[model samples]
Target chain A: MIPLILYDIPSKLDGTYWSDNITKSRFVLGYKGLPFQVEWVELPDIAPRMKEIGARPNKLADGEEMYTLPVLSDPNTGALVTDSWEIAEYLEKTYPEKPIFSNKSKGLIYAFGNAVISLILPAAKFPIFRASQILNERSAEYYITTRQVMFKVKISEFSPEGPTRDEHWAIIERAFNTYKEWYDEEVGKWLMGDVISYADIFIGSILSWLKRVLHDNEWEKIVNWHDGKWGKLLADVEKECKKV
Target chain B: MIPLILYDIPSKLDGTYWSDNITKSRFVLGYKGLPFQVEWVELPDIAPRMKEIGARPNKLADGEEMYTLPVLSDPNTGALVTDSWEIAEYLEKTYPEKPIFSNKSKGLIYAFGNAVISLILPAAKFPIFRASQILNERSAEYYITTRQVMFKVKISEFSPEGPTRDEHWAIIERAFNTYKEWYDEEVGKWLMGDVISYADIFIGSILSWLKRVLHDNEWEKIVNWHDGKWGKLLADVEKECKKV
Candidate 1:
């Protein structure tokens, strides 16, 4: 009878959501019409709090623990799922009806989900830098500090501005262009033809993140590419999942 | 109805097959229970011959026309499908029976098929060199000559024996290992769980090519990796498509 709780880290500015994965999980919840409450855990508290709630850390290659956002705790299933893709799997498993992943293509969807992430990460430096800007003061501090150490450069140094930022933007545009070629013909307004599936959700989620982060002019530049493909898809997502 | 004609490049040794793509197309034909005849086109003649048959060339980035194999001409529909993924789409659209692609996952399957090829291409130097060794005399000569000119190295120089070949093999093994990590559990033998789809066919075709080209010891080494995952999948493919 109780609603599910989605654990996410909130931004400082009016506690708005920012992470692509969190936005995706929210879309799933909204799409499924699942009653869910957002339980905002600040970045610093996420690790200790998540572990306290028996949710495990995402292990790095070198055995380091990585506590991440968008951990969905389904009170109905008495399970806490971590990682964006894993959260998708958990939701699909728990809520069989209103399924995002088609049974026939669940495995392929998983691969494509990973593929989408890979495509996004190549030009992610800008967004990665911008991400810290939206976080709460302490979380932003934690983010800038950790990421600076991680990249051996200040967050500002990553994206810089002007030509360098433009190069990163071009990479993203090119990546999406490569994806645009995947369409044999633009018959339907979706990846799986007329049907709206997880494939759309995956890319749309990232698009949503970019839309939220990028300045209006930058977002305007993107929405124009491929005859406004990204613009149209985001519109469809918003129309389909109003709660998201 | 007259049988469909699959245009392919045959290896020299008594007209044996060696191409990954042609083999994949063969798998599709057999799996669909469609009657098809192989029309062996020599390597040098493929572009001109295909152009004569009203089949188009796959253009390179430089806009040069490059004709490739596994072009399927269906006498029934009067369709000449070029490229492996395009062939898959054509077959699915035309036959619409005994479907290898689940309509729900067709888009994702295409993406996964492309992913499989990308994973295979990095360590393809050995296979690229070995490919010439199997071709007919004129074709082998043409292949070595063209490819040597392309790479600015003799065919023998590309995949020279010793540690270099070993390193190339390791890349392939590591690629497959990366794929192995994609699976969350060892539940089913197939990529899309119990059901075999185009994703399996794509990778299986590459495995078949490797098996045909690699020495028994080298092939055995691959078959043993990932707990005989590649070996078993190829077996399943062969069993499913006897003609292939």
Candidate 2:
């Protein structure tokens, strides 16, 4: 049987996948032990490629549709899915034996992810801005240009230095600490007691992405925060996050 | 065994409990089959009562701590709990039988509650504004004065009669429909599949509030929304939401 195909974007420096969104899909595939092949689509070519595959484009905040990567195609079932969340849903539905999300925890996982994201976005803006730096020339240009429009600020102003940057990191540190409390309350190593599910993958995706994009010193700070909670989570999922 | 004492407020029409906040604690107590007694504390008297019981005050937006109702004291454990969410936590911890929140889903339940509350609070303004009308004279004055400051809108302007009200209800209907999809996808009648938990109680509390405070026509519209999810949930919980 032909392996599933994952559309991913590569880091310009090494021509390997570096996108957190792409990593999210990759991690889920690895977790389920699903055989999948990766195809690199540069940032600029994503729209046309998505259009070619009939993958759904995301609606931007202003109601404009924008194409994105981490598009998954299942050769076995002839199913195509776009967006990391939808890809998780499609994979879980088509391949149910090794489930990423049990029916009981699916909605709650989404809710938990949303809550964490809303808290972290202010701090996350820093990593997102840094992420644009990893794209290949044309992809980098496309990413920066589009993001500037979306962010309504130049990339230079995105993650500032001094007190403002300190505040961002402070918020980031505090946010991680805040979520650690949830994990602390639980009985098992995973978020949902003994069960390992999509919430772990979602969080692991963010941490993996941060590892690749953040400066070594900044990354060190994260690794140390919450008694190495972020670092340990990355370690836990790193095996399943193998490059396709 | 001395029954748990729950501090509550009553409607002026009769000295019976009509508060959704108080109803939430009552519902949980009933669900746990824990015997509880209610003592009515008029709105004006809530602060003194809470202070007297050593129940913690809720911090306002500006960091001012203010007393509120639904303060529960467990005579068995000598535990004094304030806040509905905390009350759920305390009950589950102290009782440990017929738990409102299982250890695994507790954090996720909180996450889901926050998500729903964030969406509903705007539309909920109508009922909250109306709630003041049910209070006795001094309580009514205290309720309106505190709320008008918190809402920063006069009671007259709180739930306006034109396009703005339409927009608010539209948002309310849309929010319920959106959450209903989560329930629809699940295998069981409850939010988190077959296992009933605090998420259901949280949703039920808001629905109970709406039923008591919304106009007949407005409440009817909610009863029919999302295939009568609101109405059915009220039915499901009303048995437990007794006037203790």
Candidate 3:
């Protein structure tokens, strides 16, 4: 068996967190029944190994660089994988016993699933989200202000009839509508099908993060559908952190 | 030899050019000098196959939303791959003779290469670069106005003792300034090394787009470097397109 090590860097102002996409990869690996050791090294302590591995410097100023997290290493293959989504792909490919992207037919579905989740990583990291705590007292006002700016940009990019940016609310609302319509058509526990594929895991991870960042009860309920299904699986894997 | 067919939707919108990253796969496939077909299908003509393939409508306006373009159908494997980068991976994996990501290293370099290219894509699509005829008369003014807004955002984000957003400037000015610090490093022809990796193709595509969009003398020099490297290769591939 190849020894797998996750070289984790500590969180900083740049929105690095143990629960971010990098750590979620460990969960995915665990879900696939893969054994890996976690070497949780804080940023200050990461210099030597990073240099040895020729890891690029973290670019984001407030926290660690966005590109640097969740570095995966397999000494046997002498493979070091970075980029959270790509790491998931490597794990799935390397360990085919329990497949993540089980079928190639559903590649786009899985890609979109992963893309949605990956989108959350940035959306969650938006400076506004970090300022959420400080702006909690003025949450409504801040939300209105920031959301207006975002909406203005969206409307400017796509006129009343142009292709809507899915990241925008109107588009996201439409996506939810589409998902709901599809769910109604086929009552499946997962997004793509009966079996959990990478899509389920990807959307599940983002839903998990959404549940964390969203404060409103209505929004919580909407995102919680995922909790009843894949959320439980993610939480179970997350419980492994305690054991670690 | 597997029969591969690529359906492309050409649009200036970044998402439309699905064939961008996978150009190398197409290049390698053709250079294997195998027989294949490349079909440039406009958005109007791509609905039926898209539904059959279960592509989620990415753009809301198109109710008939298809995933990113350049969907490849491999009759031999019965695989229909979507998402530009994944298509490249499939091509490399399935056709190992002339591998796109030749140095496996478990896809570490491939992921970073893709990421680097992604960063360059947005920079290329920054309106002024793409439709210079519309913006050229006002581009100088536009550049100053946009830079000021970006600088203000940077100041607000990193207030008081503002860490120089100069790196952002460095990336933008890369075409104009050849002697930037990163350039002095003699980091080979590409970011990774001598061998042409996906990063080279991805970065090369973005650089090409920038050259076409920017049309500045300085950027032309940058394109000249790319022309000597990736551009020549792409032109050779254009021959295969004629056959397709």
Candidate 4:
């Protein structure tokens, strides 16, 4: 049995999907048929252990940087893997019997799907959220240092000019729309085929987050898939995430 | 030999020293000591082929909504791997003899290095670039449409804000600074060890980019590494990139 440290927030019951990767990881654990132990470390308490393990937070700490959450560790191999994509790859490689990536074609689709969740959507949107939260603070140093990445957003007219709440959701909406268009043309239902790949798990988890933030019109198309099998699993994980 | 098409902008290379996954592919081809033919497709020209492959670009027609560059296809395997990290995985699995992801420890580090390049740094920097770029335009539709996954700056930022003349060289400074601190503490020299991993290749290629955007200060660091073995290879690449 591998010891998987979930280092999480205690708010899943509140229905907050704090990290998209955590939400996705839960679904992967369930779908992959692996019964593993999850150690819940509250985010506040994660500092020392994170440093000891060379893991950082995904969000900034008190003037410190953040690393991604939901790291998978095989105590047996002493392999501590962070980053959702890396974890997915690790699990796929380690658990070839059950098979996550399974085949090359499937793996490519999974990689593409992972890129959508891991790269494109977040790069385009997270800064808007950070900028909105720190807007009125006089100490731009705190703002800039704390979120050095969002500096690019400061130059955008929308940063100082437009209302940011609308900007954040707008980015999310655009991403979803782009995904919908791609989904329609490609494998449509699942990101790859009828069978669920790691991509489905990754995308479905984010879909949960979007649903939480989106208005009815924005979420209408995305919610349909939730009614299916994987959707139910994601809903359950959302329950776990809210507990954090 | 499987015919492979690499959609790349020979002029615009990315990632840091450790990101030599693409170069590693080329290196492996060289190491296999076999002559292999590779086709280069410029960034601007990939639109039609992208659409044909069912990927949608955000602003670029026929491009993926995400920054989908360095796509590799094994005509023999009919396997098209996107994302440099994925390409490394695909190649290692397909060519097990001279495995790129040599071992579990190496794989863990390689994956970590890839994430640093692909997610963490970009997440920090891209939003600022996006907000600034669209600041004047400031249309809700425009903001929303482009927000899905913003294209990462192929260059770097040294100025207070926005892309500057020294922007490309700035990328190298920021990228090297990131690893320098890590090198001082945990592992010395290259990301994993003396022998290069994907991280080394990623860093190497990006260094190649910085070398092209040469400044006296920039070339000071470049000259140190260039005086070595890789420096020679990098000089060769610099010439090729300039030729384009």
What does chain B score (TM) in every candidate?
0.93, 0.93, 0.57, 0.56
Candidate 3: residue pairs that collide = A14-A62, A14-A63, A59-A65, B30-B33, B129-B213
Better of 1 and 4 by lDDT: 1
Give the alpha carbon lDDT tens digit for every residue of B1-244 in model 4.
7556555433322321112334545544343333344554443445666767754344343543554556666677787766665666666667665444432333233323544465335333333333333222333234334443454333234233445534543554455444443433223344433433444455556554434334446456646642353465455443432321
Question: Residue A22 of model 1: what lDDT?
Answer: 89
- Residue B208 error for model 4, in Å? 15
- In order, what DockQ does each candidate have? 0.40, 0.47, 0.03, 0.04
Model 4 per-residue lDDT at A98: 48
Q: How high is the lDDT of residue B120 in model 2? A: 72
Positional deviation of residue B115's Cα in model 1 after best superposition, in angstroms = 2.1
Q: Select the stronger candidate by lDDT from 1 and 3.
A: 1
Identify the superior model by TM-score, candidate 1 or candidate 3. 1
Interface RMSD of each: 3.4, 2.3, 14.8, 12.8
User: Every prediction's TM-score for the first chain?
Assistant: 0.93, 0.94, 0.59, 0.63
lDDT of 3 by residue, A34-104 (tens): 67777765544455666678655555434555345667887867777876766876777677776655433
- Candidate 2, superposed: residue stretches over 4 Å from native: A13-15, A59-64, A122-124, A162-167, A170-174, A240-244, B13-19, B58-64, B122-124, B151-159, B162-167, B239-244
CA lDDT of each prediction against the hidden true structure: 0.79, 0.79, 0.48, 0.48
Among residues 3 or more apart in sequence or in different chains, the pairs in candidate 1 whose N, CA or C atoms overlap within 3 Å are: none
lDDT by residue for model 4 (A1-244), tens: 7545544433333443345666666666666656656655544445566777776455442365665467766675677777676677676667665454533333233324534654345434443343333333432334344344545544334333246546655555555554554444323345434445655566666656555434456456445542443345456444433322
Ranking by DockQ: 2, 1, 4, 3
Which runs in model 3 stand beyond 4 Å of their true positions? A1-118, A121-233, A239-244, B1-25, B28-33, B36-200, B211-216, B220-244
TM-score, predicted candidate 4 vs. hidden true structure: 0.43
As a whole number from 0 to 100, the lDDT of residue B215 in candidate 4 is 42
What tens digits encode model 1's per-residue C-alpha lDDT throughout B1-244?
7899999887855448888888888888888888888898888899889989999887665578789988999989889888877787788788878777765556677667656656667678898898888888979888899889877887788888898887888789877876776543325777767777777777778888988887789889999987887898789888877754
